[model samples]
Target: MSFITDIQQRFKKGTIVEKLIYVNLGVFILTFLFNTFGFLINYNGNFITDWFILPATFEGFITKPWTIVTYGFIHTQFLHILFNLIALYFVGNLFIQYFTQRQLLSFYFLGTLFGGLIFLLSYNYFPAFTDELDRSYLLGASAGISAIFVGIATYAPNYQFKLPLIGYVKLWHLAAIWVLLDFIQIPGNNSGGHLAHIGGALFGFLYVNQASNKKINFFDRILELFKVKRKPLRTVHKSKSRKTKPTSKSTKADYQKKVDVILEKISKSGYDTLSSEEKAFLFKQGKK
Candidate 1:
């Protein structure tokens, strides 16, 4: 009971990245439990996996639309969840340093959606994948992790990671290698999954570019199509006869300047080198 209480407490207090890891872990255990229960009942098919894993065909997707996002949390194999959660922990923490937690959620979920869409489309349209459609169901969190990884790399192309053997490598260079591997391996065993990875990577690249005011013309316009319209909050400003206060534009300018400085520092060094105060300031600003 104490152990379970501790876990509950940790989950409640954890950051979004940590929460996501916990959710994935929990789902993984539950998935196996469901499989075991089925096995005991003389059933061979795992209903949890069947209903939650993203299907390759449009008809399968139509029956289980929620799988688009749910599949990101489901993992059948131990190594699959292990690697995914590890990537999510590192990349997701890096992501939140430069982006809001809300935006992290956006990239994660939208990445999954786009990845699933690509999987379905490729299986249907491409001649090579047409035969594999019935048997090739997608599962795992690779696409979301790829999006977060590529998104940050796109945001700070010059950011360097110091590896023991290889010294320092630019973030974009690593991203390029990652994507190239996926591209080259697409024709191998996991065509649908690799295609989905590319889809997520594209979203991350295009999204960060568009958000950073770096327009790729047609691609930027296409990203704009993903924007969701929410009801605007109508605020009525009254005439003030009192002393002058800093204008909103001026405040925004100051905030943006600070952000630019922090981002520049991140580009130079890495996110880990930031002082606690700097991290706090960035986190505070990110929430806004």
Candidate 2:
């Protein structure tokens, strides 16, 4: 097939995460064109302004409540989107292996919401910026990206990723480094944005942990509510069992044995007594 056909096929079969990246890229291009040439032709696009997060005091929320969500889609510059898209490209596929498209989208937007809330609250409430600036703004996908990172890392803490020069690193270590960096930098740097990062990371961690326990599962219910209904239903007659069948394969004994061991380990030395491999296997089994 030709290159264009190949690209078309990929798009047709691409996951929702990939499609969202495409949409963000398309919007960025439109904004760039409008800002550059369209302005000279009488079409000025403060396009980012339309989606940029504004303080609660500015009445922006009244006029553009949608900005709370849309701002995550808007990037300030080429490099800003470039780095984020690259991170998504690598991490997004890894996340899709276990999470549904809806769940992934939820994490993204929810992360953004948490991030924006922190930014607004800090700027308004803290003594840092409230006295100097009447209003402040934030625009980027970093918070959402950070959330994705934390989510995937939380899910599979021992999963290793190899870099060209640095060799392989465990996911949990990476998460720790990121979280620590954000914590250390919050005091002097963009306090609002850093606080937002912490908020996103917290959400990511809680999302994975809570999901394991079945405590958080809005996606399934939402999908069921919107699912299409069939026009008609067919009834089937029940058939009697032909005979008692003997099972060739059995897992009850094996499953119980493993469960007992895990329970014993938890009871004796606490849950952290389990090894990383043991924990990962248990987590995988729990999902199943």
Candidate 3:
């Protein structure tokens, strides 16, 4: 019970990306357990999982619309979930460095939606998939993770990562490889999945470009609608002479000046040159 409570507390306090990972892992575990039980009972378990997977046909999609988002959380294969989760952990961490948690959720969900739409359209209209349309169903977090991976790369193309064998590589280089693989695999088996990946990656590229310029987030309204508003605490003071300190307008000007100085230093010398105190101050300002 204590362990469960501790987990619950951690989840509640975790970042959006962390919470998303937990949800996906939880769903995967439940699906695995149900399938195992069904196997022991000699029953077909796909019927249970199928409802959450996005179907190719428009008619089937209309009947299970929620699958557009839910499909990204359903994974039956161990290796599939393992790779997706690992990509998500790294990409999500990188994404949050330049953007807010809300934007991350927006990119993830909107990317998943776009992926599903592309999958359905490709299956229905493409001559290559006409025969497989009726039986196709999509599942797994690949699309969502692809969005995060490509989104961050698009936002920071020059960012570097050091790998064991590859040494140092630019972010865009890795992103290009991923996108190229998806494009090349479209003609092979699992074409629908690859197409969906391309769709998600495309959205990631477009979304980051637009967001970087306009500071717009499509998911903000939806998130706000569901957000729980906390009531402000009321404090009663018995003293009649309680005085608050008056903040000078120069304080704001001084803070902005300091921020500008730090930003200029970052542009000239890179972020690593900033002192710890300067970094903390910049971070605090960013939260505002």
Candidate 4:
């Protein structure tokens, strides 16, 4: 009872990443319980799982449209969920450091949505899958996890992660290996899964490219919340302080100048050569 109570409290106070993991874990346990009940009752199938796992064909999909996102929550194999939840714990935490909770959820659901669509398309279009389409279905959180991993790597390719035996490696290097493995595994047993992974990776790449070019700053909303709301004050006998403050355009121009200078240094000397201040400044501007 104490253990369950502790989990409930943690769930209440935890961040979005923890909440997602808990939801996935809960669903996994429920799935096995339902399966066990079905087995005891002499039932052949668990209609509960079928309603959530995505189907490859259009007819099958139209019946359960919600499976596009729900399938990410169900995992039958222990090893499958183990790898996915581990990856999510590390990469999802890294993701929230730079992006908002809402944005992370967006990337996750959108990635799953895109991956499912790609799987459906591939299964229907390719000659090899024409016979398998009727019997085919997709499951797992790999697509969503791939999106979060590749998304961060695309946003900051030079970012490094330290591995036990291999030392430090650039995020892009890991992302490249991830995509490459999926590509080479296309001829293997889980071709649909691989194709879905590529789709998620592609979304992550394209999304970051477009977002960086547009200079979108989702953190501005968060920053706005911390600002104190003070009433206007009357000037004391019209002092020099009465002058109007610099416009937003000028402020933005100044920020751009600093960013340009830092970017120049990175280009000339590499990101690793940057001082702590410069690296901090780059990260700040990136979120903005």
Candidate 5:
């Protein structure tokens, strides 16, 4: 088979997470090849040093609006891309087993978006980064990947991973340790990057909860706008058609029953009397 065809087959046969890893690696390899021996010409007249996500520079931000998205695709160092691709291949693949491709995609892009937001916020607002000389450029996909990692951990807290020395460890434990390390290291290392990591994690957690509730799927809404809406039936209520009785108990009935009990408890005792689990259940039912 042709080389290109073989790669295409591998991509098609791979899992969603695997496909993403492959795509990222492929881009990295192509970038390196195109810049082979420093013989490659700069297409946009920008030096490698100038090519990065610089939120403070209006010109940089406007001219390369796509940089917010493309920054994650570019890694200057070989190991920078190497570790990211490896982490994504393993953590991301495990995440997909529980989440749909749509969810994973949302987590990734939205995480990246929030990461940029935090980067801008920190650069513009923080005292350390406010100085012109101190302002720094951002690169790498670590922020977004951190989000995906923590997200999967949160959703399935009990999910276990075995380490070489450590026995099976719960996902939440791993997530907590990761967060702690980031928080502790923030003051010493790249504070902006750590801040971005937190932003991405928040997006990931919110995205998962939002998906569970069915309140809104951003992609679904985007697709809906382009979809042609059909007209309602003109024969509606022509003869007042007999109401069809539900064959089984309606979900609404079950939901109402739970609500009624909660209300009774609240009325007899007080709002504070409700346990956390009960409160969460009622809140979720209210959304329905």
Candidate 6:
């Protein structure tokens, strides 16, 4: 009980990205355990899990419209969820550095929604999927993760990551490679999933560009309408004498000089070279 309470406390205090990971992991574990139990009893588990996967056919989709979003949270394959969670962790961390938590959530759900629409359209209309449409279903967080990865890469094309063996690679290069792969794989097996990835990537790229220019987020406003309002907390304060240190122009200049030095260091050595204190200072400056 104490262990569970500690974990719950940590989750509550964690960042939105961490919370998202926790939710995905929790769902995957529960699904896996349930499926294992079914397998032990010689029963087919897909009967239970298939309800959460978005069907390719229009008739099937109308029956479980919620799967369009729920499917993004369910992954039966271990490697599928593992890779997605890893990408989400890094990309989501970087995304939150420049965007709000609400924006991140919006991008994720919106990406999933767009991906499902693309999947349905392609499966129904495209000649390639005519035979397989009735039996096909889509599941996994790849679409949402692709959106975040592409969105951040588009927002900061020159941002560098020191990848193992690859040395240094620009953000755009990584995003381009992923997009290109999806584009080339459209006619191959799992074409629906790849097409959905491309759709999500396109949405992420366009949305971030618009958002960076201060365009309205209609999806965010829609989410706001459903949020419950909380009563404002009342507080009493006691007045106390406190000495405030005034910052002079010289001190401000000195701080700016330090920041410039840190920026130069980052440019030369990459972000990983910075100490925790330096990283925290950079993060604070970014928030401003």
Best by the TM-score measure = 1
Please provide TM-scores, in order, for all candidate models, with all chains considered together. Answer: 0.83, 0.69, 0.80, 0.78, 0.68, 0.77
lDDT of 6 by residue, 225-256 (tens): 54622111111112343334337988768767
Clashes of 2: 0
Instruction: Rank by TM-score, highest first.
Output: 1, 3, 4, 6, 2, 5
Instruction: Mark the 10 consecutive residues where model 4 has the least summed lDDT.
Output: 229-238
**How far in Å is the alpha carbon of 129 misplaced in model 5?**
0.9
lDDT computed for candidate 2: 0.67
Indicate the worst ten consecutive residues by lDDT in candidate 3. Answer: 228-237
Better of 2 and 6 by lDDT: 6
Which runs in model 6 stand beyond 4 Å of their true positions? 40-43, 212-288
Best by lDDT: 1
Query: Between candidates 1 and 6, which one is better according to TM-score?
Result: 1
Error of 2 at 165 (Å): 4.8
Any residue pairs clashing in model 4, and if so which? none
The segments of candidate 1 whose C-alpha lies over 4 angstroms from its true place after superposition are 213-258, 272-288
lDDT of 5 at 234: 12
> What overall lDDT, based on C-alpha atoms, would model 6 receive against the true structure?
0.78
Per-model C-alpha RMSD: 6.1, 9.1, 6.8, 9.2, 11.3, 6.7
Give me the runs in candidate 4 sitting further than 4 Å from their true place: 214-288
- Per-residue lDDT tens digits for candidate 4, residues 1-288, read 999999999999998889999999999998999899999999987765878999999999999999988887778899999999999898888776555666667667767877888998999889989878888889998898888889877766767776899987887899999999999998888988999889888877766665645564442342244342211111111122233434699888997788777655543434667789877666655534
Tens digits of per-residue lDDT, candidate 5, 1-288, equal 699999999999987677777767776776666566356553543343355454455556777676665566667678888888888877787665445555566567667767777777767777776564245666777777877988877666666666789886777788788777777877765776677777777766665565466675563453354352222111111122344433556866876687678755653443456799887765554323
What lDDT does candidate 6 reach at residue 262?
Answer: 73
